[model samples]
Target: MKIIVDAMGGDKAPEEVVKGALNASNNPEIEIILVGDEKKIRPYLKDSDKNIEIVNAQEVITYDEQPVNAIRKKKDSSIVKGLKMLKDKKAQAMVSAGSTGALMAGGLLILGRLEGIDRPAIATLCPTAKGPILMLDIGANSEVKPKNLVQFAVMGSIYSKEILNKYNPTVGLLNIGTEEEKGNSVVKTAYSELKQISSVNFKGNIEARNIFDGDFDVVVCDGFTGNIFLKTVEGFGMYIFHQLKNEIKKSPRYLAGAALLKPAIEKIRSSMDYSEYGGAMFLGIDGVLVKCHGSSDSKAIENGINVAYNSVISSINEKLREGLKSVTEKGE
Candidate 1:
């Protein structure tokens, strides 16, 4: 299997991203094609070999650039070039630590969506209380219709079962209240539809506080609300890290005890790290499109590579296609 990576998409540019591709290229069967400025990548990239090759590109889309505009104007941009590798069938999957909007737009406009899928949602893997839970629409469709929420539920359920091995994965809709009648029109309508699917483990609505409480295996929401939920967890986790540091500095005795628990604390932080899960793939797309964090490091990028490779090996797109087909046939 071959994967295309945008070498200059993240904050560290070609350096960390290139290092990641090299680190990930250890898998002999997986070939990696790095797309970016060859001049800059050559220095940072390790020994030139058969597995990892650089495809030179001229420009890069900044975090602030308009997604559609940048893709249209910057013909040789790293994002577009990397996507083209997938479009041309030169690569099985594409991974990029670039603007989320650009990747989503490019995946839909360039790589295209799978048959029977309306709007593609970004699926994020999170370490929940029970185990890893799949959350859909982390930052894809903000204004999701009731049908979109139902679609996310179906997709996440199948993905979790296929990838994470969660048989009969329990599905929950993210809402302010747990009661069936305690949400807005969207949640109310979505809850009704989700209940209609006998295959789905519809467990009722989920509150953000209960998200990490380990009640369900999958959480569903539109991109806007899901994005807010994702970032809020990230922010709170970081805040706790800083607070513990400050408390450790309060006294010598506390410092000694803190040092004892430092390893455990660090492990918790690492467990909460989003980088460990790799990029959020735009599910329901024709081909696999993995989106990494804007500030991802080499390790994070490797995780992204592994995710894309696994999706290809596991036939994630094919499973999603069949899943959507079953849902549509049910007329739910």
Candidate 2:
């Protein structure tokens, strides 16, 4: 399988991105095509093996640039070129740590959506007490209908089972309370519809607090709520770590205790690290589009490429097609 990597999309640019592509290319069966300025990317290729190649992309889509406008004007941009490779079947998937807006816009405009999908949702695997729980619409469609949530549930379920290797993953609708009538009209209507889908294990409403408690395997919500929820967890987690370090520096006794607890602390931090989980998949898209964090390091980019490879090997899109059809037929 061939995967395209946006070598100039992240904060570290070609260095970190190229390192990641080289690391992922250790698998003989996988060929990685790096998309960026050839001059910068070539130097990094010296240590890489035969599985690596480069495609020149002169322009880049920055975070400040308007997504649609950048995509339209910058025809030779790394994001646009990488996505085109996937669309043209030159690559099975595309991975980028660039601007999320540009990636989403280019995905819709260039790659299009799946056959029966109304909208594509961003699905991220978040750490939970039980394990990694897949959440959808993390920042895709700010406004959505009950039908959209229903589709997200279906897509998330198939992804959980096929990629995450979860069996009969329990699906939940994120809401203010666990009650059926707890949320707004969109979620309320979605709850009613989710319960009727036989293909999905639709659990009742899931509150924000219980997200990491691991009770639900898949949680569905509007992009607005989901994006806020994801960012808040990330920020709070970072804040806690910072506060702990400060507390440990207060005295040698606290420092001693911190050293004793170092392993446990590192384990927790690793679980919460965004890089460990790789990239979020733009589910329901015609071609695979994985979005890494903007500040992703080499390890994160490698993990992202691994995810893209797994999705292709597992035939994730085909499974989604079948799963969506099954759920749609059941709902009808």
TM-score of each: 0.97, 0.97
**Local error of candidate 2 at residue 235 (angstroms):** 0.7
**RMSD to the native, candidate 1?**
1.1
- Model 2 lowest lDDT segment of ten: 323-332
TM-score of structure candidate 2:
0.97
Query: For model 2, what is the C-alpha lDDT against the true structure?
Result: 0.92
RMSD from true fold, candidate 2? 1.2
lDDT of 1 by residue, 91-166 (tens): 9999999999888888888989887788999999877777668899999897988988888888899888887788
| Residue 4 lDDT (model 1) | 94
Position 124, candidate 2: lDDT:
95
lDDT of each: 0.89, 0.92
